[model samples]
Target: MRFLAGLFALLAAFFPGAAPAQVVDGAVPGRAAAASVTDPENILVLDLSTGGRVRIWLRPDVAPKMVERVKTLARQRFYDGLAFHRVIDGFMAQGGDPKGDGTGGSPLPDLPAEFNYLPHVRGAVSAARAEAENSANSQFFIVFQPRFALDKKYTVFGRVIDGMQYVDAIERGEPPASPSRILRAYVLADNPPPYVAQPSLPLPAPASTLLPLPTGPAAATPKSAPSPKPVRRAARKATRR
Candidate 1:
């Protein structure tokens, strides 16, 4: 017991980012710790074929249509056992194409453009496309820093709700010498108890965000002042007489 405790302590101390499993199993020193992943969808696990597993929390509200597309592809094993062929340090780590080229796409039909004005902030999950904006299929990339160049251009749908450091730990470049891969990619909120719907009225416009209409209500004007009443003068002349 004392030896095991000492071992655990050493692993936790030296391998600060190493998960407990990695600690015991002799993983890299500065890798990310593993944790149980739970999202509103379902428990989606991302096991790296090279080593270790991670949890992903997908956002459906942000890109409902895209999320549905990804889930559909995952169900059909579109990304099963696929490799993270392209990995760039201090920039982004991309994958999900079966062809293993930065260029391959899914067998399914192409997706329509869902570009929004959202920023390409760090940890942002966005669709990978070709020359066309509406060409996003199954390939995607996770940004590690603000990619302003991608803003207003790419379709940003999700983010790294958890397990980002693990992604950073992966080896870089196509066919990484270490061969990092996502053993599986699954949905989290496949089927949950649906939210109860209650009738609600439209929200009032916020003054700050309200855009002045080209022609709405007329500009308010001050009302005309009523005519001043005539001042009555004292009638003391009769008294004087």
Candidate 2:
């Protein structure tokens, strides 16, 4: 376990502009220490449809507005039953869209970019946005492999501190024929309700029903990238919009 931890530390050391807040001494890789969460309010807990709970340590220090947006949505139970609409093997799982299609976001206004020094290492949670840097709303994704190319290009508001195995278990596809989902999301400080298995919602509306894509110099049709390698390669490209 220490070997795995040391490898992550080394990766951080070699990666330019990696955030220092999460690289703690004696930290285990994949399974971050639960005690690392000093403030429960900063912990975002997801009870996944895949079964088991995943805890992400929200980093307001680097991406305050993005974190606030996430917390606000969770408090509203806005994420309950949302499908992991886009999951790429060895890449990331993208979700939090109300329309269950990549083009949708919450009714809330879009937020300006809060890009920071946080590296897109495994377990990193970043906001999904349109080409316009300020277009991120309720959509976000969790990194399953280190994606250095994504660093500073996306707003990383949190990192999975535990239950990554469950994240790893998320079904893989642009839209998995049997996609996994978030049963519920909560701010740990609020003592949200426990997980209970719920019947799946009808499959997401077909692509033909997708909302109009955002329009601007930054806008592009949202599409899931192809599968990527485990390390040091420019993984498949996706708009994450």
lDDT of each: 0.55, 0.74
lDDT of 2 by residue, 122-208 (tens): 999998876566777888888877777667778988999899999999988767888788989999999877767676565485321
Candidate 1 local lDDT, 127-226, one digit each (tens):
7665445566777777766666666666777767667776777667534655466766666555423222222222111101000111212221211223
Superposed model 2: Cα runs more than 4 Å off: 1-36, 206-241
Q: Clash pairs of candidate 2?
A: none
| Winning candidate number (TM-score) | 2
Worst 10 residues of 1 by lDDT: 232-241
TM-score computed on alpha carbons, candidate 1 = 0.58
lDDT at 172, model 1: 77
